[model samples]
Each structure stands twice: as structure tokens, then as C-alpha cells.
Target: MANKYKCINEFVVDSYDENEQVEENDFFIVEVGSIWELQDESYLSDVRLMDNEGRWLEIAQSHLVEDFVKLN
Candidate 1:
């Protein structure tokens, strides 16, 4: 069983390279109303989520504050 979430706020994330380094000029925005599924929650600061595209992303827990609502 997986928990789903709906985005309530738009947020931007930097693109990372194969080495996991942030690309200075590359970023993407997660628009409001996007839905994501919880992938992993073992990390203390961030949780992994799978977007509609099936891409897994790890975002800061703080960013989720007031930004998403869980849908069980």
C-alpha cells in the first residue's frame, strides 16, 4: 500500500548530474496540483516520491509543509 499526495504549491528543483552534482542553470518546477506517491520515508530530512512519470525524487520534508496533502 502506498500513500499518495497532491501538491498544493509550486516548487523548483535543481537538476543533478550523473555524479549527483547540481547543475547551476538546470532546474525543473513541480507545479501545484501534481500528484506523487510515497516511495521511501526512511531518511530523516527528505522523503522519496514517485511522480506521474514514474520518476523518483527526494525532496526536503520542510518543502512539503503546507505544500502537499496526503491522500490515503
Candidate 2:
């Protein structure tokens, strides 16, 4: 399919707001698949969430970058 890549999964990075607008500096949990991309392998993302709009972002780190394997 020529548009196979275009069918990639999409997500709306929306921050938890009750009465006000949320900024990008605000932290949030990306709820999607069971597996999540951790920042520097510390179970977090360097970038944060913001606004009521869909600020969707995809995270992918190469395994060669660092050994983020959790030790038992």
C-alpha cells in the first residue's frame, strides 16, 4: 500500500484539566499501548503535555542509544 505509513497509530496528547487550560510544561501520562517510551529509560518523557487540543507526539529510541533494560 502506498499509504501504509499514513495509517500509523494516532494519539491525542491532552493534559488533565478541570477548569483551566493546560500548558506544555505540565506533566502527564501517555495512555496508549501497554508499552510506553521512557525518557532516558527512566520511565518518563522529556517533553510534557499541553492544551485541550491534540498535541500528539511519537517517541522512539534506538536500543543502541543506551542499555535501558531494567535489572531484576
Among all candidates shown, the one with the greatest TM-score? 1
Sequence-dependent TM-score of model 2: 0.20
Identify the leading candidate in terms of lDDT: 1
Clashing pairs in 2: 39-44
Candidate 1: where are CA atoms >4 Å away? 41-45
**How high is the CA lDDT of each candidate model?**
0.75, 0.32
User: How do the residues 1-72 of candidate 2 rate in per-residue lDDT, one tens digit apiece?
Assistant: 111111123343435345435555675553322232322222234322221344323333342123223212
lDDT of 2: 0.32
Tens digits of per-residue lDDT for model 1, 1-72: 678999898988766665656779998888889999987563333777778785555677876666889987
Q: Please identify model 2 stretches exceeding 4 Å from their true place.
A: 1-14, 34-72
